[model samples]
Target: MNKVLLIIQREYLTRVRKRSFIVMIFVVPLLIFAMGAIIALVAKDSDKLSSEQVVNVVDESNIFSDKFHDVKNIKFKPVKASLEQLQVAAKTNESLLILSIPADYDKKNVVKVFSKKKPSLLITDEIGRQMNDIAVNNSMLQHHIDPVIVKSIKSNIAVNAVELTDTGAKDANVGPNMAVGIACAILIYISLFIYGAQVMRGVIEEKTSRIIEVIISSVKPFQLMLGKIIGVGLVGLTQFGAWIILSVISTKIAGEAFNSPQGSMMGALAVLQTIPFGYILGCFLFYFLSGYLLYSALFAAVGSAVDSETETQQFMFPITLPLFFTYILSVSVLFRAPDSALAVWLSIIPFTSPVAMMVRIPFGVPGWQLALSMFMMVAGFLFTTWVAARIYRVGVLMYGKKASFKELGKWFFYKE
Candidate 1:
């Protein structure tokens, strides 16, 4: 145990002291802040930056004669020219579009748009909305019904989601919950690959350089593998913790500098307060460590089987496929249907549970499901570690010959 701890300390200190690691720890947060500031400034001046577009209308029906109004950078003008003439004219005018409404527009409710280039969806949608409103209002007037009454009856309802707990009902912030859930899942996904790859690379480097032979003389293969995985995981935790602190500080500074209205800031704060960040953070740490352990053990096995990084490619895909699949499912399906059968199954499976469960957590996973997922994750890592140790003990000393799946199976079954 003490030997394992010593290996862990050596591995942790060796990488964290490197210049590149230190540089990235401080530089990434600054770069992210700078990019955000630049985007905000550009968005604040987008209207001024955009050129005005002219839409010439040739309405044969004349119903929309006075209804067309200018909005944003788009100007609508009523014109008498034929459709062909405007189409020809539009070729030379890059910012000009022609909207031709047929004589039977009310009956057909179809309008043709021609432009030198394809018109944006925003312009098309706006024009369609206006035309639909005009047709509806005209139809209502002809039937002696008031459009104002109909409009007044259409209410835009806002729903407040409240989750009932055994203790009491608490307000649920759906947007923030989804945002935080997806964010945590993504973070775990990236960390697993990054730190797991680091373990594999470290193992390969030691083996290739003949350093492992000397190190193996002092410690058991399982201890060396476990120590390296845990040490690198601790490094990941340290980097993540630092990034979170830096990001929070940077966000606070930016918020103060931007000087948002107090009411809006308070409203944002209220939304944030309902997100259950403590629970999410706790889950994130658990999943990150367990997932790292699970994948890194496989990574270490792959690394040991090969004498070089290039040889690792054959073994890497099988280990990485589950992580990739889970990430896609978590994004595409889990967010929309956290309680769906597919999501429930994905979250319970040990191979995918780390990412899958993290995504479902913010949406309020059942206590039983969460417990089951955690149990599976723990079991999954332990099982992988045992298998990896079996492979690692033999593979670390192997050289001059490439390894195959069949050979790895042999290695796993070899008795000590």
Candidate 2:
């Protein structure tokens, strides 16, 4: 235990002191902010490009009744001319593009657009939106239903989900919950890969250099392997902790800079106050540790078995596949129907629970489900550590040959 602690201290300090680690701790958040700024600038530029475009709406059935509203910078000019007249008019005037809604538009819902050149997609999208609104209103009128009543009914529907817990009813807004859930899941996914690979690479570096020979003479192969995994895991946690702190500080500074006289901050920083940071950070630390410990065992084994980083690729695929599969499902399926049977199973399954359950957490998971998932993950990592230790004991001494699945299978049966 003392040796493992020493090893952990050495690994954590070694990595934490590196210039690259220091640079990355600050660089990552800056890159994220820069990316958001670039996207916003691009969107603003696109809006400018689509500005002041004239759209001629020629409605034959008078469905819109000349009540067609302008959207963004697009001007809607309802022309009383025939289609042939409009087409002829469009031929001479390059800027004039005609949108012709036929008399049977209610049945067909087809709006023909005539332009001298191909019209911008933005202009067409706005036109389609206006047509859809008009069609909805026309349908409501045809059924003798009041549009105002329909609008009122739409406005009245608000879903505020509250979870009854030991404390009390908790606010469960799906938007913020979904965001937090996905963020936690993604953090675990990234940390697992980043730190797990570090474990593998560390082993590969020592083994290739024959430094493992000296280390194992003093410590058992299992102790060394366990120490390395735990050490690297702590390094990951340190970096992650720094990122969270910096993110909070940056957000607070931004909020203060943009605070209005009404006490609300401008831009997106206003949203920071509403997020349950303590809850998210608590769950994140637990899952991050669980996920890293779980995957790093296999990564350490892969490192010990292989001669170099390049050879570890073939073995890495299987270890990474489950994480990838759960990530895809979390984004597409789990967020929508978190309590579905498939989601429930995935969340409880040891291999995928770290990602799957985090996504389910914000949506409110059962207490038993959370407890069961944690148990399975804890048991899974212990079992993995045992198996990986067996491989590490024999593989660390091996040299000059590429390992295969057949060879790895043999190492499992070798007596300690």
Candidate 3:
């Protein structure tokens, strides 16, 4: 135990003293600001540039738009002569497509639209829908029917879904449901990958430099591995906490600058107001610590077991695939059926629960559901650490020869 504490102190101090640690603790906020500035520039340019679309309107009945609507991106030219004019305009890039309305075309039925470009389908459909509505309203007015009645008939019907139980008290608003869940999941994925890869690379570097052999002479292999994991984990948390602080300060400044009611920082601040913020936060802590610890341990073991970084490629896919699959499935389940059995089971399963449960939390979860998921994640971390420590004990010393899956299995059974 004394050796473990000494190793932990050594590992923590060694990394924290490096220039890289100081740069990392402060650089992320500047990068985030740069990203925001880039996004604003892009948005401003996009707004200034008009979306280009061509319309060859053949109003055979001589109804509207002879000269065209003189928008900067879109130009409307009157087709007085023939169908040939429309076709020519389309071919020459003067227009995108042709819209033909026959002279005898009945105003009572459906409208016809023709477009060569499949990408313009939505634009054409929207135009057709707008024209249809205009025609219908004009016809109704001509007949002296009350427009209010038509308006009432076309009004959007809304449904209210009130939950009887207050399962997700911290996340009550439907507005923040998907966004909050997605943010939490993303935070978990990013945190795990960043920290786990760090652990892997650190192990490889130390082992390659012959530093591990010297350290191993003074410390047990398991103690060295555990200390490194805890130290790196603390570094990650430090960076993460710094980011949170910087984001909050920047957000408040931006919100005050905007002076808008909805404001720039509402989405971010909502994380605090998320009903049952405790559950979501509790899960975030559980999943992040357990998820990263579990994966980092595996990475450390692989690092100790392998001769080089390239050798880890064969094993990384197995570790990464489950997290990726869980995230994708969480997105699908968010809109499809958040309460389905598949979602429920996925949230409870440790391999996927980091993302799946985060996604489900906003929708509300049963007490047993959260408890069971937390328990499984804790158990997974403990079990994985045991296995990793066994492999790490042997792998930290053996070199030149590449380790295999079969060898890793043997390491598990090897005597202490």
Q: List all candidate RMSDs to the true structure.
A: 3.3, 4.6, 5.1
Per-residue accuracy of model 3 over 366-406 as CA lDDT, tens digit each: 88988898899889888989999999999888889888899
* Full-model lDDT, candidate 1: 0.89
State the lDDT of candidate 2 residue by residue for 1-416, as single tens digits. Answer: 89888888888899989999999999988887789779878977876765476878888888763877877777888888878988887888888888888888867547678988888888888778877887888889999999889887785567877766688886555687798899888878888988999999999999999999999999999989899999998888878888888888887787777778565446345444455678767767887898889899999999999998989888999888998999999988899999999999999887898999989887767889988988988998999999999999999999988999899999999996
1-416 per-residue lDDT for model 1 (tens digits): 99999999998999899998898899988887788779988988988987888888899998985788788988889998888988888899878899989888866647788998889887899888888888889899999999999999999998898988898998878888998888889989988989999999999999999999999999999999999999999999989888888987876765576565675555666678777778888989999999999999999999999988888889998888887898998888889999999889989888898888888999988999999989999999999999999999999999878999999999999999
Off by over 4 Å in 3: 30-47, 57-149, 157-171, 249-278
Ranking by TM-score: 1, 2, 3
In order of lDDT, best first, we have 1, 2, 3
**Best candidate (score: TM-score):** 1
Colliding pairs, model 2: none
Q: If both were scored by TM-score, which would come out higher, candidate 2 or candidate 3? A: 2
TM-score of each: 0.85, 0.79, 0.78
Q: Which runs of model 2 end up more than 4 angstroms from their true locations?
A: 30-46, 49-69, 73-125, 136-171, 255-276
User: Among all windows of ten consecutive residues in candidate 2, which has the lowest summed lDDT?
Assistant: 264-273
Give model 1's clash tally: 0
